[model samples]
Target chain A: MAPAIKKYGITVSIGLLAFIILVAIFAGQVAPHDPENGKLDDRLFGPCAEYPLGTDQMGRCILSRIIFGARISLSVGIIVVSASVTVGTAIGLISGYFGGLIDEAIMRIVDSFLAFPSTLLALGIAGLFGAGFINMVIALIIVDWTPYARLIRATVIDLRGMEFIKASIGLGMGDLFVILRHVLPNTLSPLLVMATTGLGYVILAAAGLSFLGFGVQPPTPEWGFMLNDGKMFIRTAPYIMIFPGMMIMIVVLAFNYLGDSLRDLLDPRMKMVIR
Target chain B: MITDERPGENRPLVEVYSLKVVFPTDDGIVRAIDTMDLSIREGEKLGLIGESGCGKTVFGHAIMRLLEDTTKVTGNIVFRGKALYSLDRESMRRLRGKEIGMILQNPGASLNPVLTVGSQVSEVLVLHKGLKKRTAWDRVVGLLGRVRIPEPERRAGEYPHQFSGGMKERAVIAMGIASEPVMIIADEPTKGLDVTVKRKIVRLLKEVTVEKTMLIITHDLDVAEEVCDRIAVMYAGELVEIAPRGAMFERQLHPYVQGFFQSLPDRGLKPIPGMSPSLIHLPEGCRFHPRCNRATGRCRTEHPEMIDTGDGRCVRCFLYA
Candidate 1:
C-alpha cells in the first residue's frame, strides 16, 4: 500500500537514525577508550595502530570522543525537535481549526515569536537559561515550535473546509476531536518532511552552542566542542579539526538528503512515484 | 417511507416563511436572500434552480445553519413544525448529517483525501450512530454497496485519490446516506460529471435515498426535470416561479422562468434576454424587471407576491395581474 513509504527516503532516514541510535545507546562500549584519559607519549599520533582517525593535541582518541559525542548531539536534536513538533502541531491545530478570534490571538503570538531569527532566539534563550543540554533543548523548542505551528495552521485553514472534515463533524466529532484524529493525522506529510529536515538544524544548533562554550561545557565531547578544540592545531595537527567538522557535515547532509527524498515520496502530488 | 404529517393545509414538511439573508460587506449590505418563502413536502424532490450568485446554495446553507457567522439571517425556517433559526451550533451539527445532509458541487474537494472511502463514509455512522470501529467498518461497506460502489470490501481501504470522479461522488453519496438523514441537500451535485456519469449519479442518489426527501440545487432545467417532482426557479435571491415538473415544463408562468428555460442548452440551447441581477444590490421592486421581456411600469415599482396560478403552480410576476 502506497509503495511501502518509499525506500529512497525512508531507507536513508531510517539507516542514519538507526546508526545514530545505536551509537547513542551503547557509546561507552562502542568507543575504544575514555575520551579524556590521554597517553601523552603517543600524543599527536596520526591515524595509526593504537589509535584511529588520528589523535587530538592532548593525545586523547579523536575517534572515541566523536563516537561518544553522538549521544549528546542526537539527544538534544531529537528531544528539541520532538518537543517543538508536539507543541507546535497542537497549537496550530487548535488555532487553525477554530478560526476568527482564537485563530487571530494564536497567530498574533506566533508572529511576535517569529520576529526573531530562530538561531538568535535560541542562542539568547540558551545564554540566559545557563549552560546545560536540557536548557539548550528548551531554548531550541521555543524558537522551533513557531515554524511548525505556522505551517500546520496554514495547511489546516484550507483543509478545514474540505468535505471529509465536514464528514468528520457530521459523524459526530467535536471540533477538538476532529482536529486531532482527522485533521492532524492527515497533516503528517508536511510535518514528516519538516521533522527530518528540522532534526539536522537542531543537531547543528546544539553543536554551535557547545562550541561557543554555552552548551554541555568542556570535556563533554560534543562534535562542536571537538571542532573548537581542534581549531588551535590547524597547522600542527590538522586531523583534529577536519575529522570532527567532517562528522557534522556527513550526518547533516545524510539527514538533509533523507528529508528531501522523503518529502517527495510522501507528497500526494508526486503521482509518478505512487504507482 | 413518506411522513403522513404535513405542516398545515397544503403545507409541506419544511416551510421557510419570509426568509431573509443579509451580508454586511465593506461597500453595503448584500441581501443574498430577500424575504423568500418556500416549502418542501415529505418524500418530495424539490429542485432549486438559479443562475450563478442567485443565492440557491446560500439558502440551502442558511436552512442548514451552515452559513458563516458574518451572515445575518432573519427568518422563520420551520422543520417538522419546529423553528430552525434558534438552534445552537451543536444542535445544528446534530441536525446536519443526521437530519439534513448536504453534498457539494465538487466531489474531488469535498471528501477528505487522507481518509479511505470507507472511513469517510463510516465517519457519519460512527459520529451520529455511536458505532464501534468494527460496526462502523461493516456499515461503511454496506453504505458503499448501497451507493453502487462495486467490490465494496476492497474499495473501502483505498484512499479518495484512487477513485474516479463518478466513484468519488458515489463515496460522497455513501457518506450522506450513512445516517439515513431525512433530507439531502445536493448543491449542483452533478456539475462536473459528464452527462452519462451525471445521469448515473442522479440515479444512484434516487435509488439509495428513495425514502428520504432531497432538495436538488441546480442551474440546469433538464436535470431538474429528470428527477425532481417539482421545480422552484430562483433569481436575484428570490423564487421567481415554482410548479410540478410536468406543469413547469408544459405551462410555465413568470417571464424569468421563461427566460431561464430559453437560456437552457436544448440540443443546441435556448437564448435568454439578460443576465441575473447582483445579490449585493438588487434592482428595486421586481428582481426580474431588467431581464423580463414582459416587464411593465408596475413591474418596476411594486414587487409581486408569490401567488398560486390555480393549478398548484406559483409565480411572482405582474404578468399574472
Candidate 2:
C-alpha cells in the first residue's frame, strides 16, 4: 500500500486545487442544490441512500457543500499568497538592496502593521469592509504581506554587498537590472517557502473569520458555516464537528508537509541535511 | 636599474604615494595602511607578501575603494596620473571593472551563489563594454576556457556552488579578465587550494595575463617566489621593503623582510616570531621594533621614512637610512 501521505501530500493538494478549479468552473453542477437552497425535510439526515456525510441543519448534502467550500478556501489561499508575495518581494528587494531612506520608510510602515495583533487587525479590516468573499480575501491579503516583505528585505540586505552584485555594479549593470535579474531570483526559494507555509496560515485564518460569522454570508455552505451550524446541535451529534474540523486539520497538515518537501527540493541548502 | 622610454615599452600604470588608510572605531582608530609609496608599471606582475593584519589585504581593498564607510582614507591613489580618491562615484564605478578588475580573497563569499558562472562573468562584459547579452555570454565561455575550466560552455551554466574551490577561483579569474582591464588585483588567489591546484592556477594567471599588469596579494612565499617579477614585503602596516623579487631574496634588507625570507618553509623553515600590531592601538614610534630582534633606542623612538636604495628598491628601516 502507498504511504497515507502519498494519498495525501502533493496528490491531495493537486486534487484539492483541481477540485477548487472545478468548483469555480462548474460549482453550479457539482453542488446539487443551490448553495443557499434549504429544505427543512432534509435537515440532519444521516448518511442514508441519498446524503453521504449526512446533511447539516439546513438539510443540504454535507458532501456537496464541502466541495463548494473548498473553492472559497483554496482560492483565498492562492490569491492572498500571490498578492502578498508579489508586493512583499518587490518592496523587500528595493528596501533591502537600496537600504537607506527607502529602507527606513518601508520598515516603519511594516512595523506599524506588525504592531497590531494580526487577528485583531484582520478582524478590524473585515469589520470595516463588511463580510463577503472579496472583503475576506482583501482583509487577509492586507494582514499577511508584512512578514513576507520583511523577510525579503533582510535577505536582500545580506545579498546586496556580495561580489556578484558588486561585479554587476562594476560591469555597469544599473541598479535596476541588478536587483531585477540578479538579486530577485535568489529571493525565490525562501519566498516560496513563505508562500506555502503561509498558505496554511491564511487558510486557517479565513476559517476563523467564517466561524465568527464575519466571513462568508450564511446559506453559502463553507466549513466555518458547517462548524458553526454543528456547534448548536453538537450535544446531540458531535460527528458534525468532526468532519469539518478534520477537513481543516488534514488540509493544513498537507500544505505544511508539501511546503517542507518543496523547500527540500528547491533549496540546495536543505538538501544537504537529508543526504 | 634602467629606464627605457621606447614607445612600445611600459610606463607605470598606477602610483600610490604616502597612502594612509585608518578606520575609526568606538574604542579608537585602526590604522590599516600607513603612509607608504607603491608603484606598478605597465604589464608587470607585482606580489605583496605578508602575514595576516600586516595591511596587505587592506591595501588591496583601498585600491578598489572597498572599505567600510567608517574608515577614513588620507593619501593619493593615482591611477595613470588621475587621483582615484577624488573621482566621483560614477567615474569610480566606470573604472572598477573596466579599468581595474580584482580577484577577491574568498571566491565563495564574494560570488553570488545564485547566478551561474557564465551569467556572472557576462554581467561584467555587458556592464562595462555595453556588449549585448549573447555576445557577452560567448566571451564568458571563452574566458572560462582560458582559465582552464573543463567544458566551458557547460560549466558556464552551473552555479558557483556546483564548482570546486579551484573551479570557482577560475570563474573569478574569468570575471576579472572579462573586461581585459589594465590592472588585475588578486587578493590571496591561491591561499586555500591544494599545492597542485595552486600551481595550476598560478601558472594559468601568469600565462593568460602575460601582457596584462597584476598585483597579486598572498601569504604564500613559494607561489610569490615563483610567479612574481617584483615583490614587496609589508610589516605592521608599513612597507619595510619593495624590490625586484630576486634582489629582495638576494640582498634582503630590513628586519621584517629578513624575517619573511627566514620564515619561508622551503628556505629552511621556522615560523616568524610574534603577531602583527593592532591597527587600533599600535605601539609608539616604530611598529616593527617590538618584534625586531635588532631593535635599539633609535628604532623604537622614531618612525623611519622610506629610503631609496639606488638599486631600484626601497626599505623603511634605520639600517637602510
Per-model C-alpha RMSD = 3.8, 3.6
Worst 10 residues of 1 chain B by lDDT: B1-10
* TM-scores of the candidates in the order shown: 0.92, 0.89
Error of 2 at B44 (Å): 2.7
Provide the lowest-lDDT 10-residue window in model 1 chain A: A1-10
The residue-by-residue lDDT of candidate 1 on A144-176, one tens digit each, is 899999989998987887766765565445777
- The DockQ-based CAPRI class assigned to model 2 is acceptable
Off by over 4 Å in 2: A1-26, A98-112, A157-173, A236-242, A264-273, B1-9, B24-28
lDDT of 2 at A196: 88
Report the error of model 1 at residue B163, Å. 1.6
